[model samples]
Target: MAKSITQEFVKGLWDEIPPFRLVLGLCPVLAVTKSVENGLGMGMAVVFVLVCSNMLVSLLRNIIPSKVRIACFIVIIATFVIVVELLMQAYTYSLFLKLGIFIPLIVVNCVVLGRAEAFAYKNGVVASIADGLGICVGFTLSLTALGALREVFGSGTFLGMSVFGPSFQPFTFMVEAPGAFVCLGLMLCMMNLAGNK
Candidate 1:
């Protein structure tokens, strides 16, 4: 049975969440999630690239030859990535600096490319938009939630504001590389447990 538009949009939230469910795009997921702000910024950049590329791929699906579809998709994705990079440089220089190379790396993010190859390339414009928006929104939420978890515990702050107040000692390790792996592992374990139930 074909999924309704609502189902297409809603699946990204939980059913197919990139980092937690599909487990795609772990590079930016683990790297920039030390702070909610960084996670949100990175997620938003991916949002722009994925949505625009999905739209364009859907539009040109027919004209793009099957033999060269993958190459064409990369070109489309890379174009939007450059646009996002430039926009970030202009308006969000601090965030651009923080995210650094991760911004350009969006072109290769599996989540974005997978959606293009798996969904948008075969769907209509409206459904492609819905798919892109849904998946990227889910990704944004995941990154933000992970970032918030790490930030609150590791830094004792939420979005740079101290949450635990003075004298509250932070774990500190939660912001480190090992901490990211541990936190992500725990979250993945919990998600699997919940899904199994």
Candidate 2:
């Protein structure tokens, strides 16, 4: 009952999407998605960490003992998260500040560690890479969509450029904490409805 590499990769796009379909990694999805730029930045950092961690975990799956597997996986994931943090600070200082602690919190993101334990550890390196990439793509898309929706409604802008006319008043609620929950809930409902059809 083995799957082809293509199938493995494709599933993460929708069937196994991180936040929407899989319901993993919601903290950052709700926290830093006030703007599309922030969302994309966070998502890319996650993609880098997820892919790197998955590859390392798959590569060392045999050497790591069962009792210490989770510990080993954390170490591997933390290494990549630190790399992401330093790189972001060096290149994208503004975004690095905007994202703040959430960047470091990527170390505990269920999506990265979950994949390391669930998919990467059990699969070949190629399959693990595909899974990581697919999941990251799905996650990035979700974050961007949410960020765009919130940004447009909340500020009447997309990525900081005004989209609405001068007469249009922004919906401040969309960018607030309550708005995050509301937007996410409505989106989840839509997803569920579409999935049932």
Candidate 3:
């Protein structure tokens, strides 16, 4: 059966969510999510790259040879990633510094490449756009949630504003590598339990 455009768009939000459901892009998810600002920045970059690449891939699906499809996808994805990196550096130098190498690394993110290979190449422009938007929104939500959790518990602040009172002691661990894993694990567990129920 054919799926409606809305279904295609909606599925990526939760059903096939990139990080939490599909678990495709963990590197950026875990790395830049120490703060909501960093997570949102990285998420937007990924969205721009993903949507642009997906659209291009869908547009050229017929012309690109199957044997070199992967290379074509990488080139398309890299172009958008570069654009994102330049834009970030120009407008948000602090975020650009915070994101560091992860910004450029967006070119190699599996989420972008995977969508190109698995969905965009086989779908129409509209559907590809929907897929890209849906996936990126899902990714952004996941990153923001994780970042907020870490920021609140680890730093006693939310997006740099203190959330707890003066006497409230920060956990500190929630901002560390181990904390990221633990938080992600617990979140995943909750997601699983919710889905099962």
Candidate 4:
């Protein structure tokens, strides 16, 4: 059975989202989502790495030995992650600082390596690229939503712009670590409930 390009593209959008569906790449999901800006930056970086790694892995799938495939894939993904990290440092230093260890940590993100080995290795370059793009978008949306929710409730702001005005008292817990878990759990529950409906 052949998988169409559309199938590859759409699957990641909802079916195999890094955080919600697959449950992969949760560390960054919980960490840098303090603000919408940080979440967007991190999501974009992950997308870049996933697309590049998937494309490269698909291209090299035939030649790479099964035994060393994991190492090769990791190296390829890490290279792109580094490129994104350096670019962020050069241009968006403040956002990069907010992202901190999570930026470099993209190298170890299972979603990147998982797609490379699971889909890229077995599919054509076009399909692999489509899959990567879909997954990246899914990840971006989920993270950004979480970030927006947290930022708005925690500090009464959205992306640093005040949303609730001076009268609204901010909830300090919404921006903290515990808030992340609560937000994520609630979001996941909402997503599941929506899907069931």
- List pairs with backbone clashes in candidate 2: none
Clashes of each: 0, 0, 0, 0
- For 108-194, candidate 4 gives per-residue lDDT tens digits of 998898899889999989999999999999999999999999999999999789998999999989899999999999999998998
The window of 10 residues in a row where model 3 has the poorest summed lDDT is: 1-10
lDDT measured at residue 89 in model 1 versus the true structure, 0 to 100:
98
My TM-score estimates for the predictions, one after another, are 0.97, 0.98, 0.98, 0.97
Task: Report the candidate with higher lDDT, 2 versus 3.
Answer: 2
lDDT of 1 by residue, 1-197 (tens): 28888888999998999998897999999999999999999999998899999999999999999999999999999999999999999999999999999999998899999999999999999899899999999999989999999999999999999998999899899999999999999999999999998
lDDT of each: 0.94, 0.93, 0.92, 0.92
lDDT of 1 at 27: 91
Candidate 4 Cα errors over 4 Å, as ranges:
none
Rank by TM-score, highest first.
3, 2, 1, 4
**How well is each residue in 105-174 modelled by candidate 3, as lDDT tens digits?**
9987899999999999999999999999999999999999999999999999998999988998999999
Question: What is the TM-score of candidate 2?
Answer: 0.98
lDDT of 2 by residue, 1-197 (tens): 28988898899988998998888889999999999999999999999999999999999989999899999999999999999999999999999999999999999899999999999998889999999999999999999999999999999999888998788899999999999999999999998898899
Clashing pairs in 3: none
lDDT of model 1, residue 150: 97
